[model samples]
Target: MSVRCLLPLVIVAIVAVSGANFKRREFKIKIDGEVSFKATPPLSSGKTITWKFKDLQGGVIRVMDFDYDESATPQNPLFKNCASADKKTGELTLHNLTENHSGLYFFELNGKEQMEKFPLKVMRVVQKPEITNEKTTSNPDVVYLKCKYDKVVDKDAKISWSCSNDTTEELAYTKTGKTDLCCACTLKNDVSQETSDQICESDLFHEGSNIALTVVLILLFILLFVVIVLVLMYRFNNKFHDYVFKKYEKTTCLGGMLKNLDQCRSGKKTGVKQTDVTTVYTEVNKIEENNKEDDPLTDPQHDYEEPQSGDKQTDVENGTPLKKEDNTPTEHSDDL
Candidate 1:
């Protein structure tokens, strides 16, 4: 080949070789910890990859090496130093691992391929699980049981599910990115009245972490008790009002007074004569006046003063003065 033709050919060969190496050298990240599962990155066809862990002491810990065959028995690499891998699924497990095992790892594919670096984050599983019930109603068709941790857990960690009252078993569906996991269960029978006594529990196992849900039910019971007390108080107040009205009816003479007055006006029998009414009214007035005079608060002289003797004589000659009692006080004349 001519010099110019050879240069283009050489460049094409170098480009082809670099492209092949790039595909084979693509690195994948695997996160492992006390409770984390092995995570594999998507790999291209015909690629080979190996995992090596680098400790803080600069010591290289060989994890695993495997070829990327789309139809391989163990598709994922199994690190003898760490844990084994499932044949069916490409899941890797790390045993007796700590956070210090967490760091950057390097993967070397085929010979003459560049090494690829990945980050292996090792997280401590939550020691205790926090369980909560978010249902607000007394009886709910479905109840949410939330199992959460204070921090973010590994996304590929294996979680186990269980309950306190074995009458109903809980199942965990998926892992949440926020280190918390939640599951929903349908209530088999009506539990409106029975929820106070029944408790729901969730157990998460990074290393046997568990949480119970009983405090929420206790609070609901206290609220129900308060409502019952208020209802009883309202009933008592209504009964008290009725009792007061009945007592007042028995003590007062208003009924009797009205009945007597009605009979007198209707004239069913011989009613009181006008003269008799006038005489009785005059006697009652005299009694009321005597009572007033006896009271020191009343000035009897100002209330009943007599007219002069001259005025009385003139009134008598004119026939305007009625018969007067000699024993009556002089103040009585002024009153008339």
Candidate 2:
């Protein structure tokens, strides 16, 4: 055992030797609880009883005093509101205890201190422990469990598991059976103990169902990844298509411009030749004379209509010559 485990015994032995008639008791109480200590050989009508506290640092402070026929007077300001004494029963009750109130307590009869002493220890209640299922065996028939309390408040606390097999270990394994198995975790200390909620062993160790769920999750994740990849590829393909189209349009425009520039350069190198307008007019006049030779009016079987009076008058006013087969050609004027 550690020194801390043996310290109480050492203190008890020392006190035994110092006070042969001393009666000592160790007490454990939760925070905000109450404790009552009675004086041996209860107080008489005229007797006086006093309570005193000795702190962990060996400093003593008077707590309360009671005189059966006189009055009850409290001394320590720290315990003024929390301490009370029974004048008839010679009992001192301390309420609202805290860790700071943990220490030795002494009682006095009349003017002399009593041999009985009380050692008080104040502590908080233990919290519930958690149990988890662990996979420790390759066999599907076996189930492994681990019980733990991470936020342990007491140093002397113990962790244990209560199962159908009655296990005391923090880590325990058991075989699965036809019937349901239940388990719980417990944490215990010198002051208090707490037991966790029961868990169903078979439900917790559903290996086959767990495997199926894991597979489904993995397949879903793969499908999601494939979908994301496809979406990215589609967006990239559209951008690539747009880029190629724009590049082709630009190339086509550049080629047309270059072709036009080459044509201009060729024209500059080989000078332009102009056609004569008089040759074009003479060809037109020859075509007109050939058409007149094939005219229906010159044929002997053809009948021609005479010009109207309005048409003759308009032609004469405009100084236009009237057509006749026997008429001679007119000379040109200087203005023409």
Please give the distance, in angstroms, between residue 168's alpha carbon in candidate 1 and its true position after superposition: 41
Q: Lowest-scoring 10 consecutive residues by lDDT in candidate 1?
A: 188-197
Backbone clashes in model 1:
3
The TM-scores, one per candidate, come to: 0.22, 0.51
What's the lDDT of the predicted structure labeled candidate 1?
0.46
Candidate 2 wrong stretches, greater than 4 Å: 1-24, 137-144, 150-152, 164-169, 207-336
Candidates' C-alpha lDDT: 0.46, 0.72
Model 1 misplaced regions, further than 4 Å: 1-47, 68-81, 85-96, 112-116, 125-336
Q: How does candidate 2 fare on TM-score?
A: 0.51
- Give the candidate number with the greatest lDDT: 2
Which candidate has the highest TM-score of all?
2
Across 1-336, the per-residue lDDT of candidate 1 in tens digits comes to 689879988999988886785555333223343333333443445765554667666777666555545332222233445555443333344565555666555545553333444445554433344445554355433445554433344333333344333332333233233223433222222111112222322222221232233666778899999977744443345464334434443444843432333344334345543224334545988999888877755854645547775655436557676555588568778889
